[model samples]
Target: MPNVVLLLAALAFAGCDVFESSEPVAFTRIALPARPVLVNGTTVVRGDYQLSAFTRSVNDSLISVPTIDFDRQTVLGVFYGGSFHAGCRGNVETIEGIRLAGDALIVEVGPLPDLGPCRAIVYPSDMVVVNARATSVRFVGAVPQ
Candidate 1:
């Protein structure tokens, strides 16, 4: 009877909302053909022209980042700026969470996987379409080095 009561208590506490922010922002990850070389750190792009210019900075082959409706959505780009092994690919795991706090969007980046035996150098980058209008973004729990 005691074991059952303890189990029930644990489950009940687990179900309770632990995160401070309850309001979540909708987001979708987008793929890029090559890693961006110019833009580094967190970037908030609200206009088509800004996004277009960012894509042009990539030195790799001509690529097309997913066309987003700037009026309805915004793009958030997170780049590590550091080079990693070729096996370390970004976006392999889903983004953890995005929540709204006041007018700022708080983004949580999940861990990066370790693929064995990497010889070539590569840059880790990720882009997501957030379905909310925010003036700024705060990144938490960034990609593991």
Candidate 2:
């Protein structure tokens, strides 16, 4: 009788642990400025943009490896041309990473090993801004002097 009661109590506790609620997680969205910034000679375009930042979550299960998934989020930045579109290969001194998100494209500068080759987007009205950190860049529409 005592063992049965203990087992029931343990099950109840486990159930509570499984059913417990957690606070909602929030992620900050950063908008690319209207002005383009140049970092390390690489030009980044600024506009309403979205990119994938990789992350993983695990579930409690046995006899199976943890599954990996991707979460898609939107980031505002200028659209930069892609290497495939530009017909270029290898490291291009200015561009670093190019990714397609929805209808917009993202061109990232600095160290992004995961992202493939990048190409600068050239628009007749596009303006460029240089980054002081030398690690980031952005492209945007014309900025008022």
Candidate 3:
């Protein structure tokens, strides 16, 4: 009898929306060419991806390119163009979560990680594939200004 009561209580809480978690958006890490000179900012690729800030030919091949179905998907790119000195080595931007807040879609990114001092040039970048189209997409948390 006690076991049945406990199971019912657990199921009730699990069905509650207050305890629901946001669905994570799918993403992939793209490798940029050696010493890639890219503009520092967020870039959204919609329709045709022919943006000058994102197009480059490395070894006669395109780098950081992803196949997309523009009819139902969108690509969001986060790039840290400026090189960071020692102290902040291995700094990179990571997409943490993507969820709907009110009527807008919010993309969350992890903050810069604190690491030991090391002499290395770090250029953090990420490519995220959003599954749904939104009237407005807003990026929040840890995005390079």
Candidate 4:
């Protein structure tokens, strides 16, 4: 009887949410966007902002979600439950938005955001911000597993 009780207890512990992953399994096989792959300095305007693809990096199997704040002059390459803050190397005057646009990374720029120091990260992923004078920046970079 004690043996059966022990097995039940073990099963209960294994069934806890803590033992499960928070992110979806699809993230492991997610592919990088392709628009940034065709970056040629062409400007794509939306609303009142102008967008451009200046740099990109792609991951093999690892998933890296891109996050940027022109207001804070910061970009986060998030993956494996950790946000690797790095991207943009120039003066970020303003930012309208940063998100994935159908496998493509799109950034919308406004007049200008506050000026601040640029942070760059190279490990596990690569990110960068180019042309402080430009209004927008796009990335097709990937974060491998």
Cα lDDT tens digits for candidate 1, 37-79:
5434666789987777777666544544566778778887777
Please report, in order, the local distance difference test score of every candidate based on alpha carbons. Answer: 0.69, 0.29, 0.62, 0.32
How many times do residue backbones clash in model 1?
Answer: 0
lDDT of 3 at 11: 91
Model 2 TM-score?
0.19
Model 4, 1-145: lDDT tens digits are 9999999999998888555432111111112232222211223323212212222232222323233334433232222113342443222223333554333345433432222344653122223332122244353333222
Better of 1 and 2 by TM-score: 1
Best by lDDT: 1
Reference-based lDDT, residue 104, model 2? 37
Model 3 spans > 4 angstroms off: 1-24, 51-53, 57-61, 83-93, 101-103, 114-118
Error of 2 at 10 (Å): 1.3
List runs of model 2 lying over 4 Å from the truth. Answer: 27-145
Task: Provide the lDDT at 47 for model 1.
Answer: 91
As a TM-score, model 4 comes out at 0.19
C-alpha root-mean-square deviation, candidate 3: 7.2
Models 1 onward score TM values of 0.69, 0.19, 0.62, 0.19
| Backbone collisions counted per model | 0, 17, 0, 18
